[model samples]
Target: MAEEHEDPGVSLVTVDGIEGKLARVELPDGTLEDWRLASLPQGVKEGDVIRIDVRGGDVDVDHQETDRRHALGQRTLDGLNAQTPEGDLDL
Candidate 1:
């Protein structure tokens, strides 16, 4: 049998301050993680959940963008040379 448990991730973060569009969150591990909450109230303070998300790949913006671009580029080239959901495409 396998035990069920939440993966080690960010939680119970105390919000320090919101400078512009950034929310500085202090994690349960005593480290800080920055979050971006667009159009939401910055009222989260000193002790709050703030937000919850996958901490690893989701936080690597540059690497994520590069990966996405590479995937799309590969799909485009593949589609142009083969049959795809978009129908036969021209290169």
Candidate 2:
């Protein structure tokens, strides 16, 4: 007879913080785990919420949240650029 195994169902997690290329994630059960940021979808950042499919070992980004964050970041960058002195060329 073959043995049966249970699936590790998908989990909803939030990005708590990032250190280097690793992201500290808060699991659905309130536990924290570190996952490689490179393994996750592009543009994931701190405070972003994402869905992790354990069985498939895949991570999905929350598009709406990501888009919102992206917009906010662009605004901040624009503000910084506006404050820069022209012809500085300090790349």
Candidate 3:
């Protein structure tokens, strides 16, 4: 399980996906949680990393974290792609 944020009431959650009015999120402990799509920040979509200030009752997108994670994922994908041979494969 992942440890909670240093601050008692602050933590991070990832928006795994959205369906209609609800969104499925992954908690810090890797458990699934459902939240209202309207309750989240405007323009939020799948794969967005959000910062929740539970004590302050504030929920907002953590843009830096999201971008960082995206970049890391892209690098991983690029590395994997580089490992493949550069020729067409026989059926």
Using all chains and alpha carbons, the TM-scores for the candidates as numbered come to 0.35, 0.53, 0.83
Identify the leading candidate in terms of TM-score. Answer: 3
What's the residue-level lDDT of 49 in candidate 3? Answer: 87
Writing each residue's lDDT as its tens digit, candidate 2 over 1-91 gives 0111233566667788899999998776777889998877788878776866777877787666556756886777777777888722232
Query: What lDDT tens digits, residue by residue, belong to model 1 across residues 5-24?
Result: 25566323445557777777
Candidate order by TM-score, decreasing, is: 3, 2, 1
What is the lDDT, from 0 to 100, of the residue 70 in candidate 2? 60
lDDT of 3 by residue, 1-91 (tens): 2235677789888899999999998888899889999989999998898899987999999898888877987777777777779843322
Question: How big is the positional error of residue 33 in model 3, measured in Å on the Cα after superposition?
Answer: 1.8
Cα error of candidate 3 at position 62, Å: 0.5
TM-score of 2: 0.53
Candidate scoring better on lDDT of 2 and 3: 3
